[model samples]
Target: MRLVVFDVDGTLVDSQHHIIRAMTAGFAAAGLEPPPRAEILGIVGLSLPVAVAQLLPMADLATQARVVEAYRVSYMQARGERAAPLYPGALDCLDRLSARDDLLLAVATGKSRRGLDAVIAAHGLQGRFVSLQTADGHPSKPHPSMLWQALADAGCEARAALMVGDTSFDIQMARAAGMPGYGVTWGYHPAEALDAAGAALIAEDFHHLTRAIEDWAS
Candidate 1:
């Protein structure tokens, strides 16, 4: 079976607005100024602690932990206000991929398991993925552990798997796990950055993403 792994935040859904808002609130809660939106977006795929640390390089451990919690709280509040929507064509792509018997879908995301489950449920995406890996269970992106575990769970070789994501960290993780990475253009990172991070293919839209995956599997 061919296993296809996806990143959640930027790759599947457009949560940047929530992310930035929550991040700004979190920093304010900690009595600090928020990082620029571009800086925050750049760290979208890393686990919360790592992302916070990157955003506040000079922060003490206590401050970083506080920011993390504050960010979570702010994010939860934002979710209550409005659900983030899936990217255009994301659902259609998932439906098409799910129809293929020879393919297994999985998720490798920086989100906690609970967060992932919430998104899946919100979108009625039940049973769409065979394996799910989250930051709560593994190290952050670019580490390869999540992808490796996903391949193991799917009983698929790395060579038979493709990683789809929007960040350089995701591309690096796929490379480390011996899989070709497919970058999505509409995500957090730029196409040039993805190209430099070694994306084997880049998809500008959901149609292109679906075709690229099908072609790779074929």
Candidate 2:
């Protein structure tokens, strides 16, 4: 079966606002200034600790760890106050893709297993994926470990799998894993960055994303 692996944040769900807010609170709790929204968006596909390190390159490891914990607490609190909704057409695309018997679906995300589980349950997406690889057990995005584990779990070859996401990290990871990557414009990173990162094609919307995948599959 052909495998389709997807990213979570900035890919399926639009959690930018909540992410920015929580990150701001996190930095505040850590007694540091928050980075710009654009800067934060650029790091969406990375694991929390790695992302925090990038955001606070000048800070020591202890400081970064504190920021990570603060961010997690802040994010958990924010989740109670607001839900991060899937972008329009995201569910439809997933539904259509899942209906194809020749295809297998999976998730390769930088989110922790608990976070991924929460999103799946919150969106009622349980059982839709055949494999779920998360930061809890694997290295962060752009490392290719998540994709490698996902492909192994699905028993699929690299060439038979595609990574779908919105960031350069995803595209680079797919490349490193010897697979094609498809970028969706409605997500985090800019289209130009996606293209530069070796995306085979960039889809402007879910309809285009579906068509692009089908075209590749055919």
Candidate 3:
């Protein structure tokens, strides 16, 4: 079987608005100024804890914890009203991949279980994925645990798997796990960064993404 692992936030869905809004609220709760919009966007694919730490390196542990909690609550509230929607063409791409018996879809995201579940249910994507590796169960991105788990869960070897994501972390993880990395242009990271991070292929658009995966499967 061929394994295709996807990243959650920017790769599948456009959640930057919710991410920034919640992070801004997190800073507010901690009595600190919100990070610049550019900085916040730059760290899109990172796990919450790592993102928080990188954004607020000077913050004490207590303050960081509060920020995390505040962001979680804010995200939950915002998500309840209207969640960050999947990108245009995402459903079609997923559908095409899902219909292929040779391909086994899986999710390797930095989102915690609660957050991942919310997005999955909201998008009616629960049945689309065969496995999900959440932040709670493994080390965050740039680590191979999630990808390794995905391979194990899908009962596929690393050489038969492909990692699709929007950031360097995803590319690095794929490299560490001996799998090919496919980068998406619509996601957070720039094409240059993905190339530098050792991405084997970069999809210029959704159609290209689908085509690339199909070609790989064949």
Candidate 4:
């Protein structure tokens, strides 16, 4: 089977606002100031633990733990009330891709299982992804565990898979997995940065994304 793995936060969902807001609350909970938005945004694709570490390098272990806890609580509450918006055409792209018999869809995201579950259920995207590789199970992006797991779950070889995402971490992970990576321009990372990271191609919109996949699979 041909497999496609997508990143959730920046690619499929525009979740930066919620993430940043919770992070700010987390800092307050830990009695530390939140990092600047640019600094926080730069580490967008890292898992929660990693992101927290990067954002608060001087924070002690106890403080870090407290911050993470607060972040989880804040994020969960906010997510229920207001989950991120799906990128334009993201749902449609999923729909088109999942319709093919030869294709197997899955997620490789830095989101927690709980977070991904919220999105899937909210968007009526259940069962559209055969497998989910969340931060809870393995090392986050820039690591190949998520992609590798998705390949195994989808019953496809790495070479037959494509990683679709919007960050350098996604491209790096795809590289490590020996899979082609397609970067989406509308996500967190700039197109130039994605290109520098060795993305196989960059898609400007969902139609372009679909065409690339169709061409690849054809």
Candidate 5:
């Protein structure tokens, strides 16, 4: 079966505001300033610790940990206030892709297992993904660990799988895993960056992305 692995934050859901707000809280809790909006979005696909470290390279481990904890708490609280919504055509695209018997859907995200669970619960996406690889056990994006686990879980080869995401880290990870990465324009990263990262196809919308996946499969 062909596998389609997706990134959650920017790829499927529009969580920019949620992320920015929680990041503000996290940095505040650490007595530091949050990075710029672009900087925050730039690190969207990386694991929390890794992302935090990038944002605060000079900070001590304790400070980074505190930031991570605060970000988690604030994010969860924000979730209770308003769950992140999927992109305009996200659900429709999922429905179409998941309906195929020969295709399997999976998620490879920097989000914790708990966070991923919240997303699934909120979106009524139970049993929607054959593989759910999260940051809890794996190294962050660009490490290839998450995609490796996902491929193993679905009994699919790397060449038969496609990674769909919105960042350079995702493309980098897919490259390391021996698969092609499809970049989404609406996500955090720009098309130029995705191209530089060696994305096989950078799509503007889910319709074109879906069609591109089909073409690749065919």
Candidate 6:
């Protein structure tokens, strides 16, 4: 059977507002300044610590860690206020993919296990994925560990797996894991960035993405 691995934020859902707001709180808690919106969004697919470090390169490790914790708290609070919504057609695409008997769906994301769980619970996506790899147990994206573990969990070979996401880190991670990566345009990064990161195809929307995945599988 083939495996289709997905990214969470900026892929299936739009968490930019919550992310930016939490990041602002994180910086506030740390008595620092948050980066610009574009700069912050640029690191959407990375683990908390890694993303924090990128945003605060000059800060000490302790401060970065503090910001990470604060971000987590703020995110959880914001999440309760408003759950991030899935992009239009995401459910339909997932439904279509799930209907296929020859494939298994999985998630490989930078979100912590708690955060991923929250999203899944909020969206009633329990049992939607055969494997769920998160930052809690794996390195951030652009590292192949999550995808490697996902392959093992899904009993899929790298050649038989497809990675679908919106960021360069996702494409790079898929490349490092020896899998073909498909990019979605409606997410965080631009199409050029994804193409530069070695995406096999850049889909315009979920409908196009589902078709692309099916075409690739065939």
TM-score for each prediction?
A: 0.99, 0.98, 0.98, 0.96, 0.98, 0.98
Q: Show how many residue pairs clash in every candidate, following the order shown.
A: 0, 0, 0, 0, 0, 0
| Candidate 5 ranges with C-alpha deviation above 4 Å | none
In candidate 2, what are the lDDT values of residues 184-204, reduced to their tens digit? 999989999999999998999
**Model 2 root mean square deviation, Cα atoms:** 0.8
Better of 3 and 6 by TM-score: 6
What is the Cα-based TM-score of model 5? 0.98
- Candidate 4 or 3, higher TM-score: 3
What 10-residue stretch in candidate 3 is worst by lDDT? 38-47
In the range 90-120, model 4's lDDT, one tens digit per residue, is 9899999999998989999888898889998
lDDT, candidates in the order shown: 0.94, 0.91, 0.91, 0.89, 0.94, 0.94
Off by over 4 Å in 2: none
Model 5 lDDT tens row, 137-214: 999989999999999999999989999999999999999999999999999999999999999999999999989988
- Which regions of candidate 1 are displaced past 4 Å? none
Better of 3 and 5 by TM-score: 5
Largest lDDT belongs to which candidate?
A: 1
Q: Total clashes, candidate 4?
A: 0
